[model samples]
Target: MKNILKVLRAERDWSQAVLGEKLNVSRQTINALEKGRYDPSLPLAFKISRLFERAIEEIFEDDKGEENA
Candidate 1:
């Protein structure tokens, strides 16, 4: 999964810790997400989308070939 989390965080001038605070996750989790080393659960995806005022599709790109097709 590819996500615009880092871009959004940069736009907000938020550190990973601050983003984690807002999302109720750990900094490590935020770091993992930003690094594309982890995929968030569905609920977490929704929460992030809402927080960023974007649709889930806008924040998280489903690059899995089957899903896109």
Candidate 2:
């Protein structure tokens, strides 16, 4: 999965630590997600989409594209 987490965070002028604090996660977690080293679980993904006021589809992309990669 690829996400626009860094884009949203930067647009808000927030550090990973700041976002982590808001999302109740560690800075490292935010860093990992932003770097695409990790994909967020469903609950976390919902929290992130809510925080950004965007839909999940807007934030995260299924790199498999349509049917297959």
Query: Tens digits of per-residue lDDT for model 1 on 1-69?
Result: 888999999999999999999999999999999888999999999899899999999988788965769
Q: Best TM-score goes to which candidate?
A: 1
Candidate lDDT scores, in order, read 0.93, 0.94
Any idea what lDDT model 1 has?
0.93
Off by over 4 Å in 2: 65-69
User: Which candidate should be chosen as best, given lDDT against the real structure?
Assistant: 2
| Model 1 segments more than 4 A misplaced | 66-68
RMSD in angstroms, candidate 2? Answer: 1.4
Cα-based TM-score, every candidate = 0.92, 0.91
Lowest-sum lDDT 10-residue window in model 1: 59-68
- Report the C-alpha displacement of residue 13, candidate 2, in angstroms: 0.5
